[model samples]
Structure formats: C-alpha cells, structure tokens
Target chain A: MTATLPGIADIHHAATRLSGLIVETPLIESQELNKRFGGRILFKPETLQRTGSFKFRGAYNKLSSLTEEERSRGVVAFSSGNHAQGVAASAAMFGVKAIIAMPADAPAMKIANVRKMGAEVVHFDRVREDRMTVVRPYVEQGMVLVPPYDDPSIIAGQGTIGLELVRQAKALGASLDAVVIPCGGGGLSSGISIAVKDASPGTAVWGVEPEHFDDTRRSLAKGARVTNEPGHQSICDALLVAEPGAITFEINRKNLSGVVAVSDQATRQAMRDAMANLKLVVEPGGSVALAALSSGEIELAGKCVAVVLSGGNVDFGTYAEIMAAA
Target chain B: MTATLPGIADIHHAATRLSGLIVETPLIESQELNKRFGGRILFKPETLQRTGSFKFRGAYNKLSSLTEEERSRGVVAFSSGNHAQGVAASAAMFGVKAIIAMPADAPAMKIANVRKMGAEVVHFDRVREDRMTVVRPYVEQGMVLVPPYDDPSIIAGQGTIGLELVRQAKALGASLDAVVIPCGGGGLSSGISIAVKDASPGTAVWGVEPEHFDDTRRSLAKGARVTNEPGHQSICDALLVAEPGAITFEINRKNLSGVVAVSDQATRQAMRDAMANLKLVVEPGGSVALAALSSGEIELAGKCVAVVLSGGNVDFGTYAEIMAAA
Candidate 1:
C-alpha cells in the first residue's frame, strides 16, 4: 500500500506557518551563469536564510506545530550542521529549550553558533554510537523530537521554496524548463518536486547527489528504498545521509524527473563558482545542484534552469581557502 | 559664509540616473545593538552592496554624469581600494573602459577584482610618487578623470542612502535621534547629512573618524580644510583619506551636528562584535559606526541611532585574521 506523503495543501499550510520564521530569500538571475549556459539561470539564494540554511523553514515549522505543553517541555534533535543551527535559532525564537546532539568532531564554529542561539549541545561519537539512541529518552520524557527530515511538517515547510520559485519565475516572466535541487535525505527535494510539479506542471525537477553517497539515485532506479554500505564517504558532510527516508523517497520517485549524481570535485568547483561569480559562500552540499550544472551532469544548454543554493553557513577560516583555490 | 549643497532636486536626478546601476541595499534593524542601547538601531548593510562598499554609489553617479564624448573615450581614476572596484564595475556597466592607477602595495584581491571587472590596472609607488601623477597622462588624453570623492554627482548618489533612511525610519514608526556616519573624504557623510536632515527635519546627523586620522574633525574645528601627514597609519584602509575634500568639507561643516573619533582598538572590537553578533564580515572602516557605539563615543545609551555599515569588501584572508584577533 502506498502511504500518503506531503502534498501542496500541507506545504501551503507550512508556508503560512513559516512565513515570519524564515526569510523569503531572493531568486536572483545570474548574468555570468546565463552567459555560460545558453539559457537563463536563476539562483534561489537560501544561504541568506535564518541560520544560513533553508533548514530553518522545516525546523521552525516543526516547532510551531507542537502543542503548547510539548513546547513548554522543550525539544531535542540530532544534528551538528545546518540543521543544528536551524533548530537552535528556531527554538530560541519560540522561547523553547533546545537540546542538540552533535558528533564530537563537529566544527567549533558550528558548536559556537548553536550555543549562541541558546541551545544546549550534547556531543557523541557518530562512528561509535547512534544519535537516535541518545534522543529516544528525551522523546520518552515528553520533549518533542524535531527530526531533521523524516516528518510531514518538515517536508511541507521545505516545499515552500518551490512555491517561491514559481512566483518569482512568473514575476521574471520566465518559464523554467528544469529545477535542480541538492538532496540529503530527500526531504527538500521531495517537497520541492511535489510543489513545483503542482504549480508549474511543465517544469522538470531533478535531484542531485554526490557520487560517493548516491543512495537516492540508486534507490530510485531500483524502485525501492536502499541504504549505502558502511564505508561510503563524501566531502559533502551535510549530504552524507546513508539512506533516503521512506516518505521522501516515495514522493521523489513519483514527481522528480530523475536523480543526478555529481562528483566531490564538481561540487568543489561549483562552490568556487558561487563565490567568484555570485559573490556567495555556499557549502559543499549546498552547491550540489550547481555542481550538476557545471559538470554537465544535468544538461541545461538550451533550457532555463533554477538552481537552489541550499546554505551558506561556512566556517570562518575555510572561506579564504575556498576563494583562493577558485 | 555657508555654501549651498545639492538640494532634493539634484539628489532626485542622481537617484534617477543610478536606479539600475547600483544595489538598493537593505536597511535592517540590529536586534543586538537595539537591545544593548535600549533604542532602535537600523543598519544600512552596504557590505552586500556591489563591490562590497557604498563607494559604488558615488562612483557610478560620477561615471553616469560624464558626457557622451567622455564616455566614448574612457575614464581614469586612482584608487587602490573600494573606489577602484566601484569605478571599474560602474564603468563596465556604462560600457566605458576604465584605466585605474593604484599603489603597488594594494591587496592582490582588490587588484584582481578590478581586472575581473575589465578595468586596466596601472600600479605606482605611492611612497615616492602620487597615483594622480601616473593617471594624469590618461586624463590629459581626454579620458574623464573620476575622482573617488569631491564630485557633485557622486555626493548626490551617496545621498540616496539618506533618502532610504528617512523612508525606512518612518516605516519603523520611530524617529531616529541621530544618524552616525563614517567619514573618509566625507563624500558619504556630506551627502547623507544633507539628505537626512532635509527628509527628516529636526533629526541630528554625526560624522565619525578614526582617532589617528581625524582630518574631517580637524577640518571642521579649524574652520578650514586640513590634511594629515602622508605615512603609514590607521587600520581603516578605506578611511585613511588624509583630508576631507573641499566640497565635502563645506557640506559637512553645515549639516553635521558633531564629529566623533574612535580608536583603532575600538574599531577592531566593533569588527569582532559585528562578526560574532551579526554574522557579518565588516572591515575596520566599515565598523566605525559600531566602533562609536561600542566605545560609548556616541552617548546613545537611550536614544535611537542609525549606523551605516559602509562597506563589506575586505579580502577574506584579512577577514580571517581580523576575526581571529578580535
């Protein structure tokens, strides 16, 4: 039996809920990219979003959906990356206590940003222990558990980007032939594909993943969910999810045109291009869509395309090195 | 005797000329500073402005004012900093070739950015010879010389920020007690002071300068233009203009309520506070307003103050080091 996934109605509600919680980041047309690619290219700069990532939409939507009693009790989550920042900032705004379980090896900058948002950060070894194991007790103790991706509200919230894309594209008097999205656990892509297909109808949606961690790409071909082997690796730390969520996978399989795989090197090049041409700081996972475009993994030589820059919360010292290499 | 500055009519024409050439940078409220000072603090974040500085507004205005014959020939300027970037980008937009002479000691990144904007760069030894000496031949050959400041159109274009300020403050339903602006050659402060005072009558305007490079302050006090000793000095590379321009000084002496000075140490602290609290990369010169706030030089404990974040175009390497030190 097919389970119901997030649809446009849910997405619309979540968008309304997340209205003030997230920034309606601009969808800017890149003159440089347009000149490089034959057709026009628009970039949705979510890097300027609250907490520097699109994850804030989902985080805030999930938190706002909670009952007052649950909110009063607090919230818990497992993330040391953009999701951590998202949850911390969202919880702070809601005046709720947040406990984030992060890998012990998380970057100091990430930890500091989380703490600055007033979240209590708990560290554990991701290689040795499961993060979910630590969060189960907190969930049992009445704290609402805001999962990073595997929830309807979260998916619906992320789908708001798709809504914005349609409106912005229409405003620009451009019909997008394709929309390329960076995928982690498929939450963002699933929601985006559903909404884009619903709103634009003719626009093709493509999800991109790093080749080293191509679980979603492989799973889509097999018509089922699949998990990566233990040794799978990628420099795109944020896209290192070993498997796609069941709900997200189902939605993506139905609405997405196809999944594209990009190399780590291509992602790096895309990140460099974003910094040089777009004057933006995009993280590895965030640049996966551009990686697909730049590396010719997704053809857009004669078609207008929208590439979502998912996040820009880069570590301080790493910015110069990235720009220098470019 | 008081000199008449550009009126609303002149500024309106400048704004009309510059509408599409420059970014309408956001006027965002500083939640942290507002809470700290017990008053509203709106920051015009020009760090995101094209070429990473407000210099572009003035530069573009100056270039746009050139006659068709002058535009067809080309333009020349001497700035190893934001003015160079601004002139380069603006000239390129106007389809005019730009020849820029810079000090040999200028940052590699700034030089590269100018080159990337299609401007021809000529380097000289500022210690032994002035940049104008190197650029004079180009100007003599009928190429229009674009001064970094000390031009009517440039001042009027920079004044657009003040127009925006009045509108933004009204939107917030708060009357700003004072607007503190950073002074380099006083182009920005001179332009803004006139516009702000005109648009929002009764609101006071203040100019800030680096302690070691208080040429504007000195000039105002002396009732005449003054110049500093030419040598290595202030950390604010952008604000080390030895003297206020003649035209700008006359405007400032009339419109400004007072001038305040901030130490190099205070500038560094403000830069740190900006990065840590606001997640922004502000150069020493860009941090002068915040420097005044943090050093208690503004006496704005319970008054609403508007501080302009004048620029954002610092080299990433410099940013990392400055952030580390702060």
Candidate 2:
C-alpha cells in the first residue's frame, strides 16, 4: 500500500493542532558568534520546548490524532531519551495511560523523569534485544504504538518548526541562504526540509549528525538507507540512532540539500559556545548542526543561516565535564 | 519643574518605533519549575536581547530621540555594565561616536567590549568622584549624555517589555495575578508598571531588588524617596545602584503595587535554576525577581505570575562556581 507523504499543507494542519499547546521557541542570535563565523546565523532553540526538546511537537501531534477508542486503550513508546518524556507528558495531558519501554542501561534520571509524568516504564535488555522486539509485546496487548519518527502525523508535527522558522526569518527581514538541522532519526530534518523547501525554495537545507553515527549522511550519499555499526561510541547520545526511518529517509532524500557529519570535539565546542555566547544549554546531539556551522564544515561567509539546537536534556555532570575540558 | 511622565501611549509609540528594530523576546516558562512553584511563572528573558540585556531598548530609543545636532556631537554614557554596551551598540548602529565612562576598577573585558564596538572608554575614580562629575567634562565637550535609567524616553523604551508580556500572556490563555520585575534604578520596574497597570489594572506589579540595595523597597515603604547605604555590598552587581532615579521614582511610587528584596543567596540559586530548568543563563542582577518568585518571598499559591529575568552578562567563571556549589 502506498501512503501519500506529508507536505506543507499537512504541516500547516499540525501547526493548527499545536497552536497554544507547545511553546513557540524563539529564534536567537549572538553578535560576537555571528561576527566570528563571518555571517549572520539565527538559532532556533527547542531546549525551551516542554520536555526539553522538539520531540514534544511530534509526540503531542501523534497522540492528538489517535481515535477515542485508541486513546482509551492507552499508548506506548519505545525510547530512552526526549521521546520518552515527550510521549509521557503528552499522554498525561490527554489523561491516557502510557507504557514507555526503555533500555535497562538507560540513565536512572531519564527513567525517573518518565515515571514522574505518570507513565509505566518497561525495561528492555540492550545487550541482547532491540527496543522494537521488546515493545512488540506491549503493542500486542491492546496499547497503541507511537513511533518516534516514522508516522506521517509525527513528520507533519515536527514540520511546524520549519513553518515557524520561515515566518520568523522573514519577520527579522533576513534572507536565508541555508538552514542546518540536526538529524537523528531524520524526523526533525526531513520535516523541516519539506516545510522550508516549500516556503523558500532557494534556501538549501542541510542535515548534520555525529561522526560515527552518520548513518543519514552515508545513506544520502549512497541513495539508499544504511545502518551505522551497532557499537560505535560518541558523546552525542541522543543522535546515536542506528539508521534513518524508512518514511523519514524518503522525505529527506527528496527535500534535503545534503547530509553532513561533525566530530565529537566540534559538537562539544558548539555546546560550550551555546552556553557562554548564546546563553543556552544545548545537549550534545542538539549541537551537531551548530558544530558544523561554527567549525565552517559548511562555507558560511556573508550568508544568513538558520540552525536548530534541537534539545537540552543533558545531565549536569556530563555538561560540566565537557565545559571543564574547555 | 513639573515635567509630565511617560504613559502607556508613549510606550505604544516606542513599540511602534521599535517594531522591527528590537527583538520581541518570547515569554518562556519551565513546566517543572511551574509545578514546583504551584503556579505558572512566565519569564521574559532579556538575556536574549541585543547586547545581552534590556538596556539596549532604552539606549536605542534615547539615541533615536536625539536631534541631528546631538547625533553630530556624539553620545556618552556613565555605566560600567549593560547600559554601556547598549549605548555602544546603539551608537555603532547609528554611525555615531560614543564615549563610555566606567570606574577604574571595572572589568578590563567590559572596557574592551565597549571599545570593540568603536566606543571610547574613560575611567573614573569611584572612591573619590562619582560617574556624573567624571563625565561632566565630556558633556561640556558637546557630547550628549545618555542617562542610564532616569530619562522619560528610556523608561518608555523599557516599557515595551510590559506590552509584549501582556500580549504573550493573553495568547497563552493565562490571567496574571501579578507581574514581578527586577528593580535596578527603578527604570525597568517603573516603566513596566505603567504599561502593565494600564493594560491589566487588576494585575499587581511588584519590584524586586537586592537586599542591601533595596532603595525602591524602602522608598515604597516610607512613601517617599530614600537612599541605600553606600558601603553595603551584594552579589547583584548590576542592581547595586544606591537610589532610584529621580524621574523613575515618581512613576514607580505611584504605579507599583509594592516593592520587595531578595537575598544574594536566593539570587544565585535562581541563576542556577534558570540554567538547569529553563535552559537560560541569567545574571546575578537579572535573577532577583526569579529569586523572589522561586523562594516564595511572595504569596504565590494558586497565582499566575510573570517575572522578568532582566539580563545575562555573567562571566562563565562566576556561573561555574555557582553551579558547582549546587
């Protein structure tokens, strides 16, 4: 069966659903940082989003699309990071019971945060089993599954950011030469590309990810989906997804100008600069596109660029260790 | 002399003049913090403003009001902090020469920042002479003096924040019980009170300052203008002004619902919380109102409050120490 992919109109519909429901994060810029890069770079910080990431946009939208009977049966998501919190919070808002499946190796704080939102946490063994195999049992038990990035509704939901970015950039009287977005499972980048490409066809949309977890970059280069090596290490925990979703990859391949990768060191530098210069706390995964922009992985001279700092759900100790290294 | 003060209409006019020039900063709120405080607390973080503070609003407005002759003669400001940067940035924008007078003991980096924007810096002996006496020579040299917080145009400019806040809060479907603002020389609080009280007359407007430098609070209590002890000290450096401005006091005295003070410790804690929860970097002076709100210094149960985190110009070293101590 062929499903029509989400488009700008769907994104507009998502914005209608999300109106006054999610925080309209601001587009911020720094004079010194912009001067250093020899360009004007506006940043959309979704760290201010409820649940500390842009994932909330998609999570709430997905839940909002569910039928009354589906909602009554409850919802479940399989993730250990911002998606878990987004789903948990959205479920609580809808007064639905939610079961969040996570790797047993996930941080205690993350699990606690999910539980704090009144969601049940089911632990999966990361060493032997993947989240899908573990979450299948719950899905079979009458609970509706909320896919992190693959669903059409989820893509449309995240695309609202792109709609907002285009409008905000225009309001600032800025002409966007390009837009850089962090790509984990490709939901955010792909959604944003669809919206931006429709609104400003001249603006190039680039997707950035960490070095070893550059599955999206490799996949785009090969014109096919490719998986990262199962055991690669990087500090950008949120972006360590194995491969791009089938639906998301299709959208990205069509709308995105290119996909790029930034080193862990550059990612940390971007995170540090966000704190010192931009006065924002960005998680490592959220800073990869910023890393690429600041490090000149992309040529930015005399350009007006927009970059997304996707989240801020980092632990203090990890953030301190990174900053202290500076 | 009986000069009329600026009212809400003046603020609306200023907002019109500043529509595209200034950043219409978003009103941010932390879900976790709101739940903990037992009320919704919206933060207008001017830390995201141009030159890293709300002072830029007033500085640019004051510069815009200057006659062409005044522009040709250049401008001078007697602030060692945010106001200096605001004036320097505004002057640079207008292609006008600017002189920033600071204490001899002011941070070298601050002096350098002003100069980097093509402004001249003059050092004054704080122990022997005040900034006014030291800047008189430059004023006599055909330079226009840009008052930090006392002028009617400056107050009207700062009042733009109040207008933005009222509109944003309404958009969020929130009815504010009171609005708490950081009081320095009373320019920000007094200006905000005029705009907010006009728009939401039933909503109380309270000014918060540092404990040792609580001249506004004391003056409100005495029903007359008063001064703080010159030798007292506090960590809220930006708010350490000894007394409210002559023009600012009259507006604050009549319009403010009340005035209060927060301790240095509470201020530091608020800074840390802003970083951890709101993902924002708030300076010592900027966090006073947040400090009061978070510390329960005011009756907050079941109330919807709006607080301003006025600025974010803290040295990372100082911020590190506070976060580490936590």
DockQ of each: 0.23, 0.51
TM-score of chain B of each: 0.95, 0.96
lDDT of 2 by residue, A227-270 (tens): 99877788777787889999999999888888788899999889
lDDT (Cα, tens digit) per residue for candidate 1, span B123-176: 988668866789989988989998887877888888988988888778667788
Grade the docking of candidate 1: incorrect
Give the clashing residue pairs of candidate 2, or none. none
C-alpha lDDT values of all predictions: 0.81, 0.86
**How high is the TM-score of chain B in model 1?**
0.95
Candidate 1: give the clashing pairs. Answer: none
Regions more than 4 Å wrong, model 1: A1-3, A28-41, A172-175, A232-235, A260-279, A300-304, A318-326, B1-4, B28-41, B169-178, B202-204, B259-284, B299-305, B323-326
Please, what are the lDDT tens digits per residue for candidate 2 over residues B183-228?
A: 9899899889988889899888999999988898898889877889
What are the per-residue Cα lDDT tens digits for candidate 1 across A1-326?
25567789989998889875566776655455676887788888787677777898888888888888889999999985788988988889989999999888775767887888899999988667888998988889989899988888889889999999999888777888999999989989998988899988889999999886788999999999898778766767778777999889988888888888898778878876675456556777889998888766566887889999897666655554554554
Error of 1 at A3 (Å): 6.0
